[model samples]
Target: MSEQTFFATAPAGVELLLAAELVELGAATAQAARGGILFRGPLELGYRACLWSRTASRVLLPLAEFPAADAEALYAGIHDLPWENHLAPDGTLSIEFNGSGPGIDHSHYGAQRVKDAIVDRFRARCGERPSIDSRQPDLRIHAHWRNGQVTVSLDLSGDSLHRRGYREATVTAPLKETLAAALLLKAGWPAIAAAGGPLIDPLCGSGTLIIEAAWMAGDHAPGLLRSHWGFSGWLGHVPALWNRLLAEADERCAVGQSRIPPLFASDHDSKAVRATLINTGRAGVADRVRVERREWATVKPPPGPPGLLIANPPYGERMGETDDVSALYIQLGERLKSHFGGWRAALFTGAPELGKRMGLRAHKTNVFYNGPLECRLLQFRVEPEFFVDRDAADRHARAAALNRAISDGADGFINRLRKNLRHLGRWAEREGVSCYRIYDADLPEYAVAIDRYEQWLHVQEYAPPSSIDPARAQQRLEQVIAVLPAVLELPPDQVVLKVRQRQKGASQYQKQAEQGRFHEVHEGPARLLVNFTDYLDTGLFLDHRLTRQLLREQATGRRFLNLFGYTGTATVHAALGGATSTTTVDLSATYLDWARRNLELNGIHGSQHQLIRADCRQWLTRTLDRYDLIFLDPPTFSNSRQLTESFDIQRDQVELLRQTLRLLAPGGVLIFSTNHRKFRLEVAALADIHLEDWSRRTLPPDFARDPKIHRCWRITQS
Candidate 1:
């Protein structure tokens, strides 16, 4: 057979790894390109590449590459290809377009033209044409144009390989599958596992790394378990050859009872352990891996010598968004240098500044894209002679840093951990709360987060050690957690540690309650009813307690308007606090009902209370009604099916907050609140109103976490 070429694309940064995978999979020869790998091989080799290649995001069989300076030329070039060889007359095909090029302004138009060309070509010859199925088509085609050259290829993987189909549930932050495989491959796990070191990921986190490592180390193909392969639907697909290829894979993957790996994984959260088990099973590697529910500090490496430890820790980036990332990173570095020795390690993180807190040096580092965020996969080597360094210092320093983080300095080491804790400790002690949580719960590298919901603080406990070496990341979390209670003054019962979870069912526990319904029953709180049953958030925001109270004190006998009313907790507060009348407007009927209940529960009655269901943004445009006071607090982001469209606070805050201004009566106050941590109020933009930020002073005694939980702006347009 003549030499045949194929293109394999990956989420940026894996092009080289995909090329490497192709070369090992028996490609005639492979070369790395901009966003994909190009190789020449036989039909069986192509099947094997699609079956076993873990690093490649999608495999594409190019049909043609030509120049199209304009849309007409682009259409003609794609229409001229042999679409019949790839798609059957009765088959369904879909098209996708990528890359920026001149003359082609719209990508959807490009895809449509190609689709039209293919369907027209088939119709011209057979008098009938294949159907178009964008959702799950028999064929997925990619159109790429760079400069004046256009390359069209068959999208051999219908969906992304990241859809491994094993995730039973995903928590706030779960690492993408493709990124996980790339991180492991970059960590040199294949070489280390193949050379005899036990492979373990103590912070397994949704089992992405554990499963990826198992497949690579076991020489098991990732795409094997997939019931469907893109090429299987192609016109030239050979059933006999496909079955034979699968049989060979089964033979190769049939591990002997003794030759299997000693993979160990642990997390303080039981839920994470369960999630890991289900994901592993879905990936077909459950029986080969042992998972445990244990804290990072207490996680014991399997009896064998330290091998390869890989972890994707929270960088306070994607999964976590607290400014305390520096402190967490410092603790992680101290733990690795103290606990892990004689081990090769790799960690993926987004916060570059926190890397300085690791204290130890990284040997090799590479950048990879994790979704829209740019992340770093850093590798470090540790010997058995490693000893305690930072953790050996003062107990108060460690505790304070862990419990409370400081955000003052911006120097070498950035000191995100020590500094945060010192300042946090001062605030906690001053406020008399024995236990307070300080953390970086958001940003780019945040692949995991510690949710302090319901007065319960959950820690990811991965990044602290990842700063140095992942060989001992969990050990560090365990050690730090052992002393955490002493600093936070939190009892054993109050502490609820959540491990990394993946795959959550809609039928399972509801993340939030109905938009306007007040179903969240209050377990505690003397002033107002607190509920999370009807919304994504429980009604009472501990951080905004003072602000809510402030509204009630000033609401006496006044008519108040609550825009984006949520649970109408403020209305209930105003009613109880002596407001004469309360009118609430929101987009969700579910929330409107909740607000009504909150008012009813507080002993406030009838005619004085009004609940109007409307998108506060659009409804406010025509209304002339005004109130003595207005309370506005909209969500930071939402994809509510009830609404006609989605809303993002990052882009819509200033405009939304400005909308609330029109509803406030002269001399009446508009108490606006936004949980977006980075909100800056755009004070100059609102020239007609006077704005005063009450975030720091409004933090109440019972809620002693970070002061930036919600920025409160008292707006009055005189």
Candidate 2:
């Protein structure tokens, strides 16, 4: 095969790495450019790149480069290429037109001109032209034009190299195969594997990184599992030479398979673990990769020399807090230092600042891109000296001092917390409640709410006023965190910290974390699931203890309807109250699922119980069914895009109650509630209904400190 110049395209920030890979693949000279690497090498080298170069998006063999100053010039340049030598007139073709210059300002028009030129040339000679197939074409052509210079190339790697044909299943946010390979390479996995060291990814989601690492370690070509390649249909492909390369790769794979080292992967999610198994099996590395469903904190190195620890941990996109995620990183770093000494670890995170919260200095940091999100690959060697307690490390003396710095009002805050916890604890125990708030801005200086769910402490720091110094607020917060463990006799890990900003409308309903760890807690006579780290509020509303209790008392022998149900904690109370039939409505699928789980937990089921995921306002307006008892606890200011119209308690409550009242059975009662501190009822507007303010009556002892926690009202037909 003759020498040819080839280009391997990679994602931005990876061009230099891809160029290095090409140079290692026998390229005479490899030059890194913006989107790809340009190299002069044997034709087989391009084929090998498609087979083994992991960071490349596509391997292109440029057929021609010319000046295409205009649409007609582009047509002539594309027409002048010997299309007959690469693609048959009867074969289908696809063009990937990129860049623009001079008259070729749009990709679509440039592509159209190129297409017309190819077919027109073919039609003039062969009497027929190849058709275009964009999805899966018989031939794939790449056109790149910049500053009036156009380069037409044959795409030897049809689909992106990221599609390794192994990910038949995936969990949310699974890393692309090429990016995963890049992560592993940047982490020095090749060197580690060469030394027969083990590898582990604690937060392995869908096994992309683990499987890619296994393949790289076992000398298996990534394309070996792929059945299709751009060159498979290209007329320029040399069948004999391709087969020889495949045979060599196969033999090397067999040899490397025998010497494969220990590889392990785990995820907290069972679904992800199952997916990892399925994907690894499909990738032909199931036997070599051991997968388990386990939490990241509990993961220990396998019984072997320490190798590498890497993870694509959740970035709190679905649900998480800076404090929660920061604590997680700290835990990860601590575990690595204590348990996996001498091992190397790489963490790929979009928030590099969070990585700093791990408390371990990074030996090296490499910038990479996960699509549009700029990410960093932080490398750490888990040396004992590096793992020493931050307080003991002299360089961190300031942080330690900050922790010790008790702000002027911190003592008062701690005192208020202790008093509240004692009072709430006694009340909760007497009431058989396992979850309730202990503090809610009891001291003005420490603007936070503290809740206890069994053994876990969920702390929500209220966004302090801008009038306060941020440094002072953070210092006070650190003091509270430092004091909590000792005051509550809980481990630091059990203390889940979150910052609570005043959220409007549906933003409060959005998840803060996707940990999926649920704790079963007792609320009145109901068994409910509450997540401390995964959401803004626990599944159960502690302040509504009395409200739900009131629901239980009134729901007996009556039909109950829960609007804006919110995990159905109130519905659960009503169900256990012997309601003949119950219907729960909410807009969130996640909450509805949680509601079902709440019902299932308490042995509530059958046709008498219904869970409808719909906008409560819309459901109320359309439902012909009437109920004897109703709970209308709407958000303070809801503006969900999923709803037909936005809802504001102050502005829309009249219409909301008007629609809800129509669904109320005659002689039945409706319990309306809101957390809007300044909410005012339009008594004159709802003159048709008899209303009584029950806000004080439903206030729980634990929430007496904050009398304005929630306002409640009882409405009945006149």
Candidate 3:
């Protein structure tokens, strides 16, 4: 067979890696291009790439190139290709069209045109047309249209090379096999493995990293486990050559396995560990790879010379809050420094800023893409000289700098804060409200909310808008911080600072810090726990002070239920109000435990004052219990892993209300509240329920400045 031009596609920032891999697999010349690599190779080289190249997403064999300025031109160019040489009249086909151009703005329309052209050509010449079989096509065609130029090719690797056919069980957000290989190659794992060094993944999710490492160390072709390929049904496929390569790969794998060094993997999640074990077995590396369920803090290095220690830790994308994720990275860095000394470490994170919290300085950093999220691979030489305590250093530097005299520009902020303290302070003391907002962006220049919890202050800076210069924002924030110690008559250590931004999904419920610090605060005959430095909110919602008081005022001898209970402050109030029974339903185990503590703190306990950990929506549907009073305050949006589908307050409000009402006994009252500012009550939909807008009536004096802080409704069956 003659030489052919092939394009090997890869993820963004991996073109050079893919190019090197193609060259190693026998390409005569490989040049890196955007999103892929261009190579010139014989037909056998393309086949070899399909079977050996670990980084390439797909290997395409170009058949023709032409001008495709319009749909008709595209169809004509596709029709002119010798379809008879590729697919028979009765064979199945699929088209993957990319890079839209003039009159081809949509990929689907362009692909339809290509498919039509091919089918029309086959019908005109052979009296029958190939059928479209997207899942498993006999012939998969790829068409690229750019700048009125078209290049059509045969996709020799179907279903993406990343799908190596070994991952039968998987946890959420497992790393792609090809991307994992790129990470290993970038870390020079092959060299380490060849030198008889061991590799360990402490947070291995489904074992993609370790499996890929084992494959590279064992000289096993990535495609050896794959049972099918795009070239299987291609008319030009040389089965004899492919068989010879497969046999050679098998022999090499056998020899490579004998010399494979110690490989180990583990995860704190048992499901993930089980998945890694199952996947390793399926990949034929079960004996070579040791899998275990171990926490990052407890992970020990295998007994061998220090090799590569890599991990893809959580980075607040799908799970964990910023502070908690930062702590995880900090813990990982500490573990690496203490236990894995003299090892090569690579940590991949979507939020590159979090990598700074790891303390150990990276000698090298590489950019890679995990799907659409841009991520960084920070490579470190785990030696004592490379370690730096960044968190402690930052705190010391900040404390030293901020301890100086307050800035003159902060006078306006200081005056306003003092005035708020004078007014809200007196009201808080009179009403026995210990946790209340002292200043809520009272001055536009500050853009922060200062809440007083007993003697400690929690200052949350609202994320500044894009229009404001970041440096300017930082300066204003520092001025506020500098002035707070003087104006509040409290030491700087009493203040905890956090940046508050709009949260999506279930991030608001995640733990910001694992400080496990809780302080008791009083409000109208109830004592609740609040943490100044551990969470976005201090477990207690100050705006709902009046709402909880109302629940307490009306809860005499009534059975109560709290939905989306969050810390169960309302339940605690109701239980103290002498309710006959109380049950709190929330999805978070952490919050549920906190609720249990709140109940015990108030000396309210028993199965009757129950704390249930479950998705409230699903629980509401399944429970047969009834209640005389219900408090329902759900997050604006929740896409928790526990939920089959996400909940939108605006979209699902009516349905949620109806479900809660089902549990409400006759003449029972339901208090539905949400912090969603723009929430509109769908009164017409709830015609059967007697609903009253209690938003104004429930607002406490402390929260009056922000009328839209929350919305409340008193609901009952008509």
- Which candidate has the highest lDDT of all? 3
RMSD of 1: 14.5
Clashes of each: 61, 5, 0
TM-score of 1: 0.57
User: Per-residue lDDT for 201 in model 3?
Assistant: 93
Q: Please give the RMSD to the true structure for each candidate, in Å.
A: 14.5, 7.2, 9.3
Order the candidates by TM-score, highest first — what do you get?
3, 2, 1
- lDDT per residue for candidate 1 within 1-718, as digits (tens), equals 4567888878788888888889988996898787788899877777787888887788888888998888788878887888887788999888898765555677887777888888889999878999988878888888987788898888776787777677786544788777788888888877777666777676666778888788777767677778776775788777898899888888777763235567877665566778898888887778888888865545445666667877777533222222233455565565666666777777788765456456656778898998889888878887534332433333444555544322211121124334555876576567544333455432222223333343445454333323655544444445335444444444322343444343122211244323232223332232344432333344555566566678888998788888878778777777777888988998767567767767777677788799999877787787888888888887777656555677777677778766767777778888888877777766667777788777776765434445666778788885
Tens digits of per-residue lDDT, candidate 2, 629-682, equal: 999999888778898777889998899999999999989999999999998899
Off by over 4 Å in 2: 101-105, 135-138, 268-274, 292-296, 314-331, 357-359, 388-718
What would the TM-score be for candidate 2 when compared with the true structure? Answer: 0.70
Clashes of 1: 61
Count clashing pairs, candidate 3: 0
How many angstroms is residue 688 displaced in model 1 relative to the true structure, after the best TM-score fit? 36
C-alpha TM-score for every candidate: 0.57, 0.70, 0.72
Candidate 1: misplaced stretches above 4 Å? 100-103, 256-258, 315-328, 384-718
lDDT of 3 by residue, 1-718 (tens): 7788988999887888888888788877888876698998778898889889999999988889998778899899888888999887899989999888877789999899999999999999999999999999998999889988999999999879999999999988999999999999999899999999999999888999999999999999999988788988899988999999999999999999987899989887788899999999999999999898887778878787889998898543323222345567778888888899999999988877667767898999999999989899999999989898775655664554445524446667777888888998898888777888999998887899988887778899999989999998999998888777567765455678999998989888777876666677787788888776667888888899889999999899999999999898999999999999999998889889989988998999787888898989889999999999999999999898889999999999999999999999998999999999898988889897798999999998878899999999999898
- Cα deviation of 604, candidate 2, in Å: 8.0
> Which order, best to worst by lDDT?
3, 2, 1
